[model samples]
Target: MQELAERAGISGRTLRHYHQIGLLEPDRVGSNGYRYYGADAVSRLQRILLLRETGMPLADIAGVLDATTTPAAETEALTGHLEHLAQERAALDRRIKAVEHTLSMRRQGREPRMDVMLEGFNDRYEEEVVERWGRDAFDASNQWWHGKSVQQQKEWKARADALLARWREILQDGHEMDSAKAQEHAAVHVEWFKEIPGTPTHAGDTAKSVDMIRGLADQYETNPDFHVAFGTQEAARFAASALRLRVRRLEPSSADDLRG
Candidate 1:
C-alpha cells in the first residue's frame, strides 16, 4: 500500500478514502493487516487521478465511473471531455491574444482595435443567439448586416440612438400612463424596428414586439446600467406598455394574435 501510494503520488489516507467510496478498493488484506491493491485497483486509481486532474467533482467522477459499462464507453466519455478542454483552451488563447494585442498597441501609443477588445465576446453572444434562435436566424441576421454599406450601417446606428434617446426622454418627463407623447415615441420605435432588415416580422406587424420589449424591461430591472439608460422600473414598464399599445394599433391584424 505504501509503495502504491508513493507511485500514485497520493497518501495512504486518500487511497483508503477512495476505497471507502468504491473508487479504488484494495484487492485484499494480508494476515498481518496490510492492504494490497491488485492491477485493477491501480488502473482505477490512475483513472480517478486523471479525472481529478481534469477538475471533475468527486460526485461527478463517481457518477461517470458508475455509468461506464465498457472500455469503449469510457473512452468515448474521455474523448468528449478532451473536446471540451480543447474549447476552453481555445477561448483562453483568444483572451491571451486580445491582451497581447492591446499591450502591443499601448506600447506603440496607438488605439487598440475592436478585434482586440472583442476577441471572445463576439463568439460568446453568437453561440448563445444561435443556441436560442437556430443557425438560420443568426445566418439571416449576419447576411443582412453584411449586405449593408458602411453609410447604411452608420445611419442605422444613428437611428437606434435616436430611438433610445426618445425612450429616455419619455421616462424623464413623467409622462401620463396614456399620454400622446409616450404613444408617439412608441410609434417611432416600432417604425424604426420595422426598418431594420433582420427584424422578425409577422404579416408586417410588430404587435408581437411586446414580448421582446418586456424581456428587455426584465433585463433592465436586474442590470443597473440598463436601468440607468432607460430610467426607473416604472418608466421602463410604461415605455414597454406604450410600445406594445402602439404596435397593436399599427398592426391591428396581428394584434389579436397573442405571443406564446
Candidate 2:
C-alpha cells in the first residue's frame, strides 16, 4: 500500500478513502494483513488519474470506466482527452510567448501593437472554440468575427451585453423557470445563438443544432466562465435549467450528453 501510494504520489489515506468508496481497491491482502496492488491495479489507477485530469467526478469516472469494457473504447476516450490537453498546452504556450515578447518590448521602451497584446487571448479563445465545435467551424467563425470593423465589433458586443442584461433582469424579477416569460426569453436566446456564423444552429443539421444548444445550456450551469458571465453561479444554473426545459420542448428526444 505504501509503495503504491508513493508511486501514485497520493496519500495512503486517500487510497483508503478510494477503497472505502469502491472507486479503487487492492488486488489482494498479504498474510500480515497489508493490502497489495498488482500491475492491473496500477494500470487502473492510471486510468483513474487520467479521467480526473479531465475534471470528471469520481462517480462519473466510475460509470465511464465500467462502460468502457474494451481496450479500443478506452483508447478512443483517452485519445480525445489527449487532444484537448494538447490544445490547452498550446494555448498556454502562446500566452507565455506573448508575455515574453511584451516584456522584451517594454525593456526597449516600445509599446506592443493591439493585436500583438491580445494574441494570447485570441489563441485561448480559438483553442476553446475549436475544441467545443470543430476546426472548420472555428475557421469560419474566426474569419467572420475579424472581418467586422472595430465599430461593428463593439456594436455586436453591445448587443450581446444587452441580451445578458435582459436575462439578468428577468431572473431578478423572480420569474419561474420554464414559465411563459422564461420561454419567451429562451426563444430570444436561441435566436441570439442563431446569429453566430458556423455554429450548429446555422449548419442546418437538426441533431447537431440540438446538441450545440444542449451543450451550451450545460456549460451555462456548470462552467465557471458562464457563472461569471451571468453574475453568479446560481443565476447561470437557473438559466441553464430554463434553457434545458425550453430546448427539450423544441426537441423531445434529445438526451443529456454531459461529459464524463
Candidate 3:
C-alpha cells in the first residue's frame, strides 16, 4: 500500500480514503492483512489522478464514473471534459501572452496599449454576436456603441459577465429549460437588449422585442463563441428554448413572425 501510494504521489491514508469513498478499491486482502491493488486498480487510480489534475471535483468524478458504462460513453465524457479544459487552457494562454507583451513594453519604457491588453476579453462577446447575426448587425450596433464613454463600456461588459455567469450557475444547478428561473433570466435578457442602443432599431419594431430575444437565443445556440461562454451547448439550447417560450407568452405577434 505504501509503495503504491508513493508511486501515485499520494499518502497511504489518502489511498485508503479513496477506497472508503469507493473510488479506488484494492484488488484483494492478502493473508498478511495488507491491501493489494492489481493492475486494474492501478490504472483506475491513474485515471482518477489525471482527472484530479485536470480540476474535476472528487464527487463529480465519482458521478461520472458511476454514470459511464460503455467505452463509447466513457469516451464521450472524456471528450467533453477535454474540450472544457482546452477552452480554459486557451484563456490562460491569452492571459500569458498579454502579460508577456506588457512586460516587453515595460522593459522598453513604453506603455502597453490598453486596448490590446483587453482585446480577447470583449472580442469573444462581439464575435459571437457578429457570427450569429451577421456583420450588418454588429455594424449597426457598433454605430451606437462607439458613442459610449469608456466607463459605460466597462459597465456594459461587467453586466454581460454577470449575465453569462448567472446562466452558467443555472446550468450547474441542473435547472429545467422552461423553469420559472429561466423565464426570469429571459426577462433580464430583454432588459439587457433595451440597454443596447441600435439592436432594437435594427429590427425596426418595438413590438418585436420577443422576436429579438428569441433571435439572440438562437444565435447563442449556434455560435461557438456563445457555446464557450455558456459552457455547454445544452445550456445554450435550454436558454434559447426558454426565451422562445417567454416570447410566445409575452408577444404572440412577434413570436409568430419569428417562428414563421
Candidate 4:
C-alpha cells in the first residue's frame, strides 16, 4: 500500500481515505494488517486522478469508472482525458511564455505589453463554456480565437478590458444595481457578449442567453478571477447584481422562476 501510494505521488492516508469511502479497495490484506494493491487497482487509481482534474466529484468518477467495462472503453476514456490535459497544457505553456517575455522586457527596462499579457487567457473559462453551452461552442470559440492574429487578439482583449474598467468605474461611482445607468451598462454588456462567435447570445437564443447570463452572474460573484478582472470584489458583486437585473428584464415572465 505504501509503495503504491509513493508510486502515485499521493500519500498513504489518501489511499486509505479512498478505501474508507468505498471509492477504492485493496486487492488483499495481509494477516499482519498491511494492505496490498494489484495491477487493476493501480490502473483504477490512475483514472481516478485524471477524472478529478476535470473537477468531477469522486462519486461521479466512481460511477464513470464502474460503467467503463472493457479494455477498449478504458482506452477511450483515457484518450478523452488526455485531450483535456493537452488543452490545459497548451494554455499553461502560452501563459508561461507570456510571463517569461514580460520578465525579459522588464529586465531590459521596457514596458510589458498588455496584448502580450492577454495571450492564452482566451480559454480561462473553458469548463464554464462547455458546461453552459456545449463542446461545439467551446471548440468554435477556441478556433475563432486561435485564428486571430496577435494584433487582432490584442484588440479584442482591449475592448474586453475597457468594458470591465467601465464596470469598475460605474460601481466606484456608487451606482445602485437597479439604477438607470447601471441597467444601461448591463444591457451593453449583454450585447458585448454576442461578439463572441459561438455563444447563446450570438446564436440569438434569447432564452438560452438569459440562462447563460444568470450562470455568469453567479460566477462573477463567486469566482476570484472575476474579482481580479473587475479590480475589486465589490465591483464583481455589483456587476453580478446588475447582470441579474438585466436578465430578469430580458425574460420578465421567468423572473419569479429565476429567483430560486
Q: What are the RMSD figures for all models against the true structure?
A: 9.5, 15.4, 17.6, 10.9
Clashing residue pairs found in predicted model 4: none
Q: Which is superior by lDDT, 2 or 4? A: 4
Question: What TM-score, to 2 decimals, does candidate 3 have?
Answer: 0.42
Best by TM-score: 4
The best candidate in terms of lDDT? 4
How do these models rank on lDDT, best leading? 4, 2, 3, 1
> Cα lDDT for residue 40, model 3?
87
TM-score of structure candidate 2: 0.49
Residues 40-122, candidate 2: write the lDDT tens digits: 88888888988888865688677667776776666676676677778677657657877997898899998643331112124
Worst 10 residues of 1 by lDDT: 115-124
TM-score of each: 0.48, 0.49, 0.42, 0.52
Alpha carbon lDDT of residue 108, candidate 2? 95
lDDT, each prediction:
0.62, 0.71, 0.68, 0.77
TM-score of 1: 0.48
Candidate 1 per-residue lDDT over residues 9-81, each given as its tens digit: 9898998788787777799989997899899878877888988898766776776777866766667667777
Instruction: Tell me the deviation in Å of residue 229 in model 3.
Output: 1.5
